[model samples]
Target: MAAQGLSGFYGSVFRRSITVQVLIRTRDHRVLLLRNGNAWELPGGVVKGGEDPRSAARRVARATLDPGSDVGRVLVLDYVQGSQRQGQAQGQGQGDSIAFLFDGGVLSTSVSAFTGAGGEREARFVPLMDWSGGTDEGHGRRWGAAVEALELGTVVELVNGEPASAGPVPAPLPRRMMPPLEGFSGILGH
Candidate 1:
């Protein structure tokens, strides 16, 4: 009985809501923002149980944006503290929430192909300069950091929509040197 109770306690403690958000853009630098009622946000959905973040992002993008959209590398990791007022948001459990933001490479086709493609009620390309007006303050901050990270080819980690005091960035890995050719002889050799 004690063991079962302990397991339940830990299970509840570890339960958290994980969501995947994609940053899709057009050639003109406009971003794709989905309208969820009055709120505007990136195209994505809650990561299903046992589903990897990348896969979830792609899946959500296909369902939310264009089917040909390719989800790229992760750009931002936003961890938000759960609030009682926002109970049972995104998924089960009322614990903290973690959002994975991925780069959804520039759309090559016309924007008309994506708008209302896959049950997405409404979606529009919003200019970067006007992103602040499309979403809430926290979302605006996170999106700004994500855009900066994408431009710098780096990743940004956030805690509650604020940049965490992460230590110095680590140096990139050294390039691998080519191996010497085998069984090669000098042309001047007699």
Candidate 2:
């Protein structure tokens, strides 16, 4: 079947979502990542209806990190397509998502402070060179792209980690990594 234009596609109506992620880093090269269910990932989730993406980033940071933590500019925009019915003949359509990976400025938190809750389990700062393994993005998968975004000073668009689109972002985002900070602990108290 031929693809319908934007108007026709809108008429059909399919579910799409906007998600926000924080590529949190410490003074060290480690990345502040999370594990939900089985995969290791950055701290972030779906953006609420009518809620600003930046605010959502801060909210996610507050919930996952210290309330005083800062949420920086977006580093990457990812368009991830949800799994479609494998055997669909054609034109059945599939779900997709638009994700914004924000630069979660260094939030000096401790590893022991990470506690599992609300479907999020084991949140910690993992060194970029390590990949203990758990979920797809647990290792350097998401972190690597985030690093590239910060270094290149551009918004990297990826469809499941492949080039697909392009968008403008801050000229140059900082590349702070994981390291032990002396003050300002995380909000997830032990």
In order of appearance, the predictions have TM-scores of 0.73, 0.66
lDDT of 2 by residue, 54-157 (tens): 99999998888667876888887776655532344444455566778899887454563366566446877787567343345422344566788788876667
**42-116 per-residue lDDT for model 1 (tens digits):** 887889989999999999888775577569999999898765313345545566788899998887545633447
Error of 1 at 31 (Å): 0.4
Q: For all the candidates, what are their Cα RMSDs to the real structure?
A: 8.2, 16.4
Candidate 2 steric clashes: 7
**Candidate 2 positional error at 190, Å:** 72
